[model samples]
Target: MKRTIRLAASIAGLAGTIVLAGPPTTIINFDTYPDGSAVQPTDAFTTQYSTVGVEFNGPGPSGNSCSISPPNHAYAKRIVASFVDPCTGVASVTSYAGTAQDSCWVPGEGIDMFAYDRDGNQIGHEFNAGGGHFTAFSFPQPVIARLDMYCILQGIDNLAFIAPVPVLRGDLNCDGAVTSSDVGPFVLALIDPSGYAGAFPSCDIRHADMNCDRRVDGLDIQGYIDAIFPP
Candidate 1:
């Protein structure tokens, strides 16, 4: 049977927010398993990316490597999942970001944030142009979220990608547009108490964390309208 290495990330925050990723940074580098486990069904995952950074390098050297470019849906909040078969821990994996600019407009406006792992894949996102959201992720192993980064380009042709802005919370309903329906979950929780045992009555944060504060409250309810139809 093909064994499954469940690569994943541990988030610093929940729903609609960028989790704090700093200090105690980790870079995966290994030719063998720390436990002497046989090499996995995949290539070794290693990198120089510190805890301060998350996205792994692409198929080349630091000074020059190709990566996913912006304007693609991936840049706007899409998830990328890849599989690793050995079930061995992930020190790092390979992938790159913001290397192309065919439709370059806002130069230096790109970001890549790696999220948790689940079954056989390094599950996360590649914010090619700017920020978006991490959604529908499930973790099977301890994972670290990283802010994929790179050095500041020093020439006129040089560029530093601008990170993505997390998706607005009021779009909680995720109906392709924010609306009153987005407020339904929070209202149910706020208006009814006897139906839930979870911290928030709605249980699903994406629905209630309107302010993306990691909590549900009147402020979030207020956050809803403000974001859907902001001033």
Candidate 2:
């Protein structure tokens, strides 16, 4: 059964608004992959999983190397002799805010996990030092785009993450309301997307896709006007 957790306290301010509900949670347990299949390399796992909103990378001095163990579990192979310096595992999501996972480590081996935002800022981090058992690690915040895991000979399973919330249509300013105030930003999104993003770093320019054709062009102008000045 899927488990649901409470939203982080940081986003509590969005309550009583159209953004009250949190984004859906997704879990990748590695069981779907064929037994003992490779999990790294763009073609093997990254590309296939990106469609589901997550990307994986296992980088080492040699090359990327990770695989699925029997039954279910993502095992990172040790490319170096010392357990202290192990392979690095990276999982990236599209504007995700938080992530968690169940991990198993060898005796005296553990993992260090770090979360980064869209701008490459470190938003959260967690570390587990003990070993020989499963441990649940989590980093909940408001915006996370990447997760880096460092461990030696560890097994990772049940990776869970919260997807990014969809931006409200026509709410270019992300103020939870579509009003006249969005006019300038909407025009900016249609004309100069980069400028619009710079003007509102927390807002999604795609909100200006008033016609829902996947682009903010001249076709959306009438719809946007109608939203701001309803008849």
Candidate 3:
């Protein structure tokens, strides 16, 4: 079943602050896959879930294996496991472009989960002493790029995450609003795309396309000015 969660975020613009709804939430229960399905070869697995914007990687640097298993707990209908040896395996789930938030999972064994941001900084961590329960991990913002699970015996199910919010046009600063604050970044995006990116790592410079002609050029100046000072 698909679920849509609406989170109101305050967006401050030249017009003032306004409430904007967040993007939908995606839940992967692994029920669609047949029992005992292989989840290895990270690239292939990622392509399968490309529409949902997530990737699964596993077995750590040792190059073990991971697979889907039949239900063994009350928390999930199916689970993914990476237990080549006791406490010697690692599995990871990464959101495309580092745009996922509020990741949760159900574990079948004791596991240590670590959450990282887009820049590879550790943002959150959780350790479940035992299995067969629901565990949720949250970070300071919706910038979670990856999640790693180190396990003694791993079985994960019912993985869920909040998708990234859509970029507001002309909101080059990525503050969820189009305002005067975006002018500087917008200029940078047109003159030096890489510089704009470095200045606002989490932002997509394409948002500077105020005229919406699919290009960030001088033509967008008027449109951006209009957004800041609408008639």
Candidate 4:
């Protein structure tokens, strides 16, 4: 089914707080397989970059039809999921992040499903599975070009990746609004680039640099604060 999911609320701190929205649920059904064995699904998707294919955790049950569902009641810039033999092994899907390595993910180990951006950043992840349930992941910003999944000791059936929604430019904290809360993430970006970028992959540095000074420092802090919360 063709649909779109947008973020209605801002994400929490670097800890990751999925802000659910009231957008339509998008579904990527992989039920069009040829009921056979295949290393990767032939269902290639056309993205901004070159086309990409769906990757499985390993050479599992040839070809199987499955579906991926995004977070329920969550406002996400982008969402992705992999359909595999639930709790069997690690199943995953890969998609195109973008040309630039400006993607990031919330870090977690031993997750049932996980996503990494073009820059090799773990944008999202989930742990454990209850049967062949639909395990999904979300990204703060839309910089996900390639998505990959794993479960530890299982195989995957199929993979599906969704399109990106819209996002406010300077909403660093992703609280649906750019207010004082953004200051924490903005400052984090300035002190620890890697940590900040990885935690809030969607928070573009350029947007955080309110004064357009090409840097996220104390200098831009004031401008950012004023711009979002103007007097």
Candidate No. with top TM-score: 2
Worst 10 residues of 3 by lDDT: 82-91
Error of 1 at 214 (Å): 2.0
- Summing lDDT over every window of 10 consecutive residues in candidate 4, give the lowest-scoring window: 96-105
95 Cα displacement, candidate 2 (Å): 13
Give candidate 2 regions above 4 Å deviation.
1-24, 29-105, 115-125, 128-146, 155-157, 174-176, 194-203, 209-231
Supply the global lDDT for candidate 2.
0.52
What is candidate 2's lDDT per residue for 1-231, written digit by digit as tens? 122234544345555452454455455555553234444423233323333455566322112123222344444542111010001112223333322223443465555666666577776666645433333323444456666766655555545556443446788888999988888988888889999989999876767766655567998899888888888
Off by over 4 Å in 4: 1-29, 33-111, 151-153, 157-160, 164-231
Which pairs clash inside model 2? Answer: none
Model 3 lDDT per residue over 12-65, tens place: 342242123333345554434223354342312322343344445422211212
The lDDT of each candidate is 0.33, 0.52, 0.49, 0.40
Clashing pairs in 3: 87-152
